[model samples]
Target: MGSRLRIVLGQLNLLVGDVPGNAAKIISNALRARDELKAHVVVFPELALTGYPPEDLLLRPDLTVRVELALGEMLREISGIDVIVGYPKRQYGKLFNAASLLRDGKVAATYFKHRLPNYGVFDEKRYFVEGTNPCVIDLQGVPTGITLCEDVWEQGPVEQAQNAGAKLMINLNASPFHKNKGKERFDVVARRARANGVPIVYLNLVGGQDELVFDGDSFVVDGRGEMTQRTPAFVEGLYLVEVDADGQVTPITGPIMPELSEEESVYTALVLGVRDYIGKNGFAGAVIGLSGGIDSALTLCLAVDAIGASRVEAVMMPSQYTAAMSLEDARFQATTLGVKYSFIPIDPMFESFLGALKEEFKGMEPDTTEENIQARIRGTLLMAISNKTRKMVLTTGNKSEMSVGYATLYGDMAGGFAAIKDVPKTLVYRLAEYRNKIKPVIPRRVFERPPSAELAPDQQDTDSLPPYSVLDPILERYVELDQSTDDIIAAGFDEAIVRRVLRMVERNEYKRRQAAPGVRITPRAFGRDRRYPITSGYGAETKNEPGGNGPAGGI
Candidate 1:
């Protein structure tokens, strides 16, 4: 018997529904692991062949056909080393999330995933049937158990594997990232390893899929709940570990990646999410309407970092009321970033709209209607450029503005993707400063100046809403945490201000519904995470029953 067992963990970024392409990558990587690393067994993440959360694509008739063909291809091409691969299995007209152990060009054993995660971005119960049995196989002279993502979260699977005489365990995962998710995952995995009294290998998928970003912080833990090996976050690569004849696991000494601070992790996630979204959707490039404010400046920086400066275009559309400082800062940022810059004065377009509506608005006083016209003109110009260039417009509305309906509909809200839609206003300033620490790309004066829409004379964001320092926390509690108006007021916020902010958020569901899809960095984003009815009497209920604690009365 071999004295040591060599295992390779494939932490990969895979595209969804590309069965043949994914199959090719698996075959190539397996060969590299077998020949170069001499790995006795190579492990891949859950649903590696089909990609994570394949969503409604699994319901397609061709899915099973394509998956079968890909599995056949992998089996025919791979040999000389054992391969544990995750794929969807269609048996007896039912689908099960499964892992197959391939040895000598054939499947030696299989393990089906018992736990189906149904909350927060996972809907596995909609597609896969629950698996019941624990599978253990002998490698060299030791027994190894297999489990899928959610299986390890519960106690049964790990205990069952140990009861079945497995000396070691491997859990495959496609877990998504939110803030501090890495620490949470480690705690859970460590507890299970100690409880089961076996060293376990945890492999996770890494990439951006739509709104979800998976950070592949894969690692191995001994029976004592000690981490033997840890891979870095937000990248793709192969990690290795070894098991001795005594079944004691030792990690190959590589760089034990340092943990990123909260700001750093979030910024990296945004960049990765933007890159994958643009690349996966095949966008030619990105275009931003640079307002020279903190929001647009930060969004432009993210775009440059995501897909090079050459691929990003910055347009400064200064209306009559636009500040000189605004133009100066916008120009400086575009020049510093080396992106293509254009100056398009919206005066002509603004005057044209006012002229057309002059007679129709004879009886009405000048109001936000005129301000919205300025925004709509800018939106029209940006969209026209986007259409001509086949580039996506990256909208720069932050969560603070988006929450209280401070943004104009089809104006600042118009874009293909909203990079900072989930980012609150206070955090925007911090991120800008963080970027500057790496290299000062954003202008200092931009941060110094008070934020404005620059549509009307001497306008400021505080003219209509509360200051962001006060506003962001209130919004976080109300929108993200779903706290009641009474709860917010009781938390030391002014009662009137709390009521006003909550009312604004409640009234703006219609606008948010029509907005573009953005990268999600917060616990509760506007779209998938927080869903509210647009046309409802809930706001009235909140006003009438300010002290009530239920959803309708809460805020």
Candidate 2:
């Protein structure tokens, strides 16, 4: 290159299925890079035109036509700077995940994603055929190679590009966020860069689609496997990086955004996930049942931070058994945050339902059925408000509760979005504390008080389940890590508690199936990440040896 190619990294947040809108974004960002940044080239995230994981929308033939038109718009409208953007392409009656390079108003080169990932949330193999060739093109006298997200995760694609005499590589991605996901991506990409001895430009899409949230921690790794530039996570902007013709990525022209702490990163991911889901779905605002517990408290903070307090509504539905402290905290939090707040007692509704069922239950003893009735009363009221006000209801249940069926289906689980469905109970407290550190919105008493559902008089969570300090770890092993009951007991948990927890998890698959989709902060979220049959008899407890202390049957 004459000097060095100043490449703009387009870390953008795109809505799925809006081809024209996404294309307009690609055009605007590309033009800004050329005119404002005075840049030679700009790289957009994978599937920028159609958004990532278009899922079965790729099955629509009209989507392909829309994509072609969008691609034409980018090629015609963006000039003076080369634009390499991703889209789904069709050739010979087969679909491929493709990236195209537009140079001088003509197609210069195109690279199909070689590796089709088919695990966890990705189902690329079902929709795309694997590509076989390596694409290396000359960019302003520099020999550059191209690859997609999963292509860089494995060893073969990078090797193929290097063997083809590529001096630099640009990999586009739509990788989603999970805990420690950034470090994992960095390790894998750095290893590939070092193995191939070529610098790489890593760009990712940032937004939320359903439960999946993409964190754009885009960076550049030098030839020796050192990351020179790292952009901020959960932010969208055009970042700049310089690449030399000598097969080296020079220092970034922009400032390196610092990496976030675990609490901060997860918190920000939840905020972004909530924001995009409401905005993309065109909801007027959000309505959350503020129960004065850790899950709901943290969710209230995230909602206010996400779409702003004006757009969020916190409703306190106090039942006859609801604690006085809970009512105090709920009102305090909503007032402190300045959201549209209201209160509706469920005693009258709960009593009417009970009166209707009294004659039929003459001999039956009152039990959890009554508790569920109260919950359903609250769910009905909040959903009614959501229907009339056009606000989406955000569920407050966490992963620990959902894993073992501590939640009531059609009752507490009734909502459009479950903001903290994938958050563990312990992490909920930590996140609540983290938000308090920023601004003391949640009261300290909410953290210090023993957790309770307050459905029954003096009811505590520990009365029906293990303490969360022990419960969360056992769940992390069994649910998230897929460990057997025996394996968990071997890891130092009590055998009976392990089996009971495992049984709850196995039996509750049906409940999780019906729960609303939420942000996935862990490796194995319930809906999309972990897929277990609800009707299976081979529960985790049965996986023990023939002479073991496993449970006899699932709950």
Candidate 3:
């Protein structure tokens, strides 16, 4: 009748559609927590069974059947301590996002999520039928409340639990990372705990799930509304905490520290994102094009840091126009990072494209079309290598290039994953500098040399676009800030440049849509968080015409 209850928060990274593998991982972590940490209970994040936001996969009955089978096996495998894990459950011909409370190899309690968030990359309502009841379970003689991700975000579930006479509320979540979202999470948990007069444990999933990267900044709040235990964001591990009858919780003495700054946090997030994406999918390794530019260098460093140097390969595809210093720096960086390096001269392919189009465009001057052709040829070679070696190709285009239509559609954008597709050009430089500060793997010329596509002879980025110092700030306001063209122009930028940049972004919709999924580090990312219609008329400075008129825009 007398027992001290210890709960382990399993902030694990689950692969989408990998039900059995995910179940095995959950059971292993639970055993470690129960045996090694001597914890009485373990709770994993929402949708840990089939992974978070299964997206269109939920429509598949076979996937659900597999999940159900996996859950049954997981229940049978789990022993000793109680377990609270999330999974998709179908009851009476309806699908529900439910969590099972397991003990002695049986489901003690099951709670379906009440609030189905449908906004901003979430379409839960469309897929799940809501559960209207509250679930309260007896944990070591004290009643504990249970809720899913969005359930605890609002006050209804928390209040219902408190009214149900529960002393502790545990929330399982798969919350995606966004700038300033960690603080917002703390605020919500503290407010809910203080208002409900009960201790709360907020657990989130970690690692990347396609375009979404869950930060896993799990924490525990006391009844008095103080955060007692906080797990690091963007990493995977078990965070153990002890909750008392008085509703006071404290972090277990171990090796978990708070994540540093937004940039550092995001950088680590990208590393974990890439690692999980490659590892979970069972890729032998990853291949990236080393353009001797900042974006590729940063991505190479991240890939090496994620899966080690031996697992990362860098290829230098230089055209006749490629700078000698750029090639030197590319070789230097490849050697410095100790990754597999190769050089494939793109001049032959470039000439082929030019010859193929020579009859059609004999009088027209060589332009970006020709440059894109060269890029496409390089892309073809990289993809061929990727197909031959079974290694995933990592595209190195930054958010800036992606934003302003600066990237080619099937050319540089052809890859299994775009490691930094959400990172801005300016941040690309910053991360490169930060990486160099550690071991100086990237050559000085990589940073010092002008950024270029090197498709045509002596082609600098500044030839067709503004400097990153200028372009990145404009893009921040337009993409992240969600400012309209007029708003951006009013934010202290040249109207002409804003208009041109906005036009480029609008015209590049088809390209961005075709690009691979990448790590999302900012408040708004390119893939999911930032959504725009391809057939639209709104853009940067077009709002204010000569008479100050244009089409209205919406986020």
Q: Against the true structure, whose lDDT is highest?
A: 2
Worst lDDT 10-window in candidate 3:
546-555
Say which candidate scores most in TM-score.
2
lDDT of 1 at 437: 95
Q: Tens digit of lDDT per residue, candidate 3, span 1-555?
A: 224578888989888888889989998998999999898899999999999889879989998889878878877888899999999999989999998899998899999999999877789987899998899998876689999988878879989877887778899998988667888888988988888778888899988877778989898887877888888877689877876554343323433466577667778778888988898788899999998878888999999999999988899998778888888888889998999999999888778777888899988986567777877888899999899998899999888888877787778888999999888888888887877777989888777778888776677889878898999999998888888888988989998888877777776776788889988778788767778887766653453444223211101
Per-residue lDDT for 1-555 in model 2, tens only? 436878899999998999999999889999999999988889999999999889999999999999998988877898899999999999989999999899988888989899999999999999999999999977777778899999998888888988898888999999999999999999999999888778888999899989999999999988778888898899999998877654454544456678899999999999999999999999999999989888889989999999999999999989878888899999999999999889888888888998999898899998788888878888888899999999999999999989988888888899999999999999999998889999999989999999998899899899878999999999999878888777899999998788777777777888899999999999999988899998775864444634233211111
- For each of the candidates, give the backbone clash count: 0, 0, 1
Query: Sort by TM-score, best first: what order?
Result: 2, 1, 3
Alpha-carbon deviation at 121 in model 1, angstroms: 1.4
| Model 1 per-residue lDDT tens digits across residues 47-91 | 999888798889998989999999888889998989999999988
Model 1: clashing residue pairs?
A: none
TM-score of 3: 0.92
What does each candidate score in C-alpha RMSD? 3.3, 2.8, 3.7
